[model samples]
Target: MNRNLTSQQKNAVLLSMAQLIAAEKAVIIKANKIDVESYRGEDIAMYDRLKVDEEKIEGMILSLQQLIADVDPVGKDLFHFTHENGLKITNKSAPFGTVLIIYESRPDVTVEAAGIAFKSGNKILLKGGKESLNSNLKIVNLWHKALIENNISTNWVEYLNYNRAKIQVFLENPTQKVDLIVPRGGEKLIAFVKQHATCPVIVSGRGNNFIYVDIEANLNLALKVILNAKTAKISACNAVDKVIINSNLIAKETFIKKLINKLLKFNVEILGDVELSAFENVSSFDSDEIWFKEFLDYKIVIGTVNSSEEAIAKINKYGGGHSAVIITKNDKTANTFMESVDSAAVYQNASTRFTDGGEFGLGGELAISTDKLHHRGPMGLQHLVTNKWYIYGDGQIR
Candidate 1:
């Protein structure tokens, strides 16, 4: 079991980490370049996440800084009770002991996830993909140095440089205690972790997000939100994959045509249902199975729904449970859509891209969880903790 550190101790380490990352930005970038060059996969989204640049370096530093500023989540009081016999009981937030995060492509998770776990007083075991070995190793080196500088154990953040077979073995029979496992990649990775790990798993699931343009929607706003959500960052998990337009929408054809044209400007491939297939450049999908797909690319599907109820039902049925957006001027309709959509994050007349930890003001997040138990949305520092019960008694018996 890992002993909890004082808030001051954790903050000191985070500060040191931010300073070191900023100071060694060049070295980090150089190491990242090696990882980028070695990656030969044709996955555009994976490639985008694999490459680390100056902007991403700044982002790492900022995440650490934010963690330093946020309140420590460990040992906070949750509930208190007093008994007639002078026995006292209290519940408080506690660390999960150890968190094993298995992630891919994104090296920044090295900084963000570990920092969040440490602040919550949990030891983090990172299992980064082989594609980002060099970059992740470099960041882990910085984490070690920061720990050493703060007179803390480097065991707080350890990296598992293992392949798929090794990871499976370790998960099936962990040499060390792993209280919780978080899989931060795609469906396959999540499935693998859940299959092998004996511990509880928090699934960072896919984002087959949706946007519904309602009859009362501001068509221009819908277009803007859709374009931004889809094209601004195609590699993001919150990127829009499907857009459902109300069948009764006034000037619906004009709006759809405009949306298609706007998307085409960015070289996005437009796919549609049978009704929308007549539009130029819009290819019709053969099956409804495509609705369940999370296209982390410059591709989108446009479909039509008869009413808000249909839209809600379809989104709940097909969406990734990550994010959904409803573009409408009617606050009542927006509220209905937002509440009906079964997603981690729901929006009204806003881009789905804002389904992020930083944007949601959690400072930063360990993961954008899709699970309902324990947590449902952004798993920030405060959300990373489990609870413990404390009892005070002087030889009291039942």
Candidate 2:
């Protein structure tokens, strides 16, 4: 394994990667074009994430630049203590050794997530989906170029070009050391990794995120937030999937009608709970299982709740544990909902789409983790490091 590269060395490689990506923009785009054209899947979201343009290339370069500017995550002092026996001990941040990240069609992960992991001092093993193979290989080649230019070992960034069966075999019996595994995709992939991997897995789980429209909410504001959260980028994990409207909301019928009309403008298919089925355009769902689904498409579910507590209960019961929001003018109600909702990110009067690493001021993220242990929310360079205890003793015995 390539271990203990200095912060300067890592930053130099990242800077070189940014320069290379910028210089080879056309090449990268050409590669992504092949992946996009070859993708036979009907998943619009995956297709959207697979295709790369000049803007996405710029985003990749920007991610590298931002990661270069961020603080080094390794070697920071977390805690210190001294014993009376002249023994000193300190806990400091350290890399997780080799981190295996298994993800789906998003090609940007090849650059952004790898940059975060590399900057945090961990050797990364990226296993991107086959749908984006061409694009991923192009990016990985650039990573190799950057590493070689810096005289750093290319082992720092390795790509596992394996299929599902091969990946399962690798997970069950890794050829190299793997300290942590992060699965970033739909539930099936996360479940598959969890079921097979021997190492500890950090789940970058689904996002059946919800929004509650409180009785005191500004309907106009709620409408705008819902529209953006649900329609702005349906492919995003932070996109809102379910909406819980307080049954007693003023002009509830009028608001629902307006929301339905607005959503229909974007060609969104609206699903409704039992109470909401009365609305003309809203289709009623037969199974409660729909609440647990993360629809990465132009679809949304609208339900009704009696109170803030009820809304909180439903969100906790059915949400993806990713993000939930409450639209309200009441501080007490907002605080209650924010504190009560069990999710990585909770919002009040804002769009759930803001639940992102860069949007939350973390430059870029390795993954938007829903796991409570190790870390939650956006796993940035700072969040990627583990801790190690260092002890100093001059002929002192325990």
Candidate 3:
């Protein structure tokens, strides 16, 4: 539905949704409580993401309001030129037609993700998991209300409640035209979508993120960053799942011991590579497959690297290509690590947690794309568009 909406019309829908969310906060929370109550999973991360409290509702409203203040993502000129035959040609931003977002356990995605697609002038179809079915339904109803209030087509926002089998069928033969598909969930869910979907699928939501503590890293800073990255929000895709330490760092054992003590407070399970086998409360990775796993739980792996080269190679081999951080005081080391590490976002002396769209100053994100095509990192409003070429000719022939 790239029907050429004026900027005012788009912002109106977002503002209306914000107001609707504010007015329906209690009802929304009530519905979310049902979802939370029905959730019987053992995964703490999934449980955490399933809950929608008052603060989370406020955050949803804030995301919509923030999106309303952003400029229109479409129709901006990327390039313009006069052809040799005197034809005026212009290349400008355009919508991706319809965007289908498949997510699990997050009702706010029903708001923020849909808002980005609508504001970009693309229709959005939401496929939320059964865990958040009640919550997602309520929020999508609010979306329909906002569209009606703005005199827009309610079809612009649709909620698809399909089982895994149904979803697989739909992906293979979508009932409607699907320009882009974004699967925002764990590795299994992403793999499911990529395996079945015929359309272009942007890989999002997996994070086997890493933080390398260089030999020159300040122990205090490394501890602080690692703790925040690993425990601040265990469910986030940007959360740190691995910590690689420089083998020759001063007092390396002491640092690991201190790190273990801090992590114990959060009750995080620590796994170590063969080099780190001696630490207490730290177990060895049962298999090499653990290196490729994105542990969305209170679990982490700590490995030792002899040099930055080893760390880079290790990360490139097993990392999710989502986010990687290097903690060091050396500028040259930071630069080389940042450039050589193949992640969507590279950090120096900062937590991997800041890979988020809001933190990166893009306002809000639809998803954190690990794929290199079209976009990478947090997919905000500006990244939701494609480009089209327009030409005006006056009887010109080659």
Considering every candidate listed, which one attains the maximal lDDT?
A: 2
lDDT of 3 by residue, 1-398 (tens): 43888999999999999999999999999999999999988988888888999888888988888888888889999998997789999999999999999998989889889999999989999999999999999999999999889888899999999999999999999999999999999888999999999999998957999999999998999999999999999999899999999999999999999999999999999999897768889898779889899988899999999999999999999999999999999999999999999999999999999998888877789999999998999999999999999999989888
Tell me the TM-score of each prediction against the true structure: 0.99, 0.99, 0.98
- Cα lDDT of model 1 by residue, 77-158, tens digit: 9999999999899999999999999999999999999999999989999999999999999999999999999889999999
Instruction: Show model 3 residue runs off by greater than 4 Å.
Output: none
Q: Backbone collision count in every prediction?
A: 0, 0, 0
Q: What is the C-alpha lDDT of each candidate?
A: 0.92, 0.93, 0.93
Listed per candidate, the RMSD to the true structure in angstroms reads 0.9, 0.8, 1.1
Quick one: RMSD of model 3?
Answer: 1.1
Whole-structure CA lDDT of model 3: 0.93
Candidate 1 off by > 4 Å: none
Worst 10 residues of 3 by lDDT: 1-10
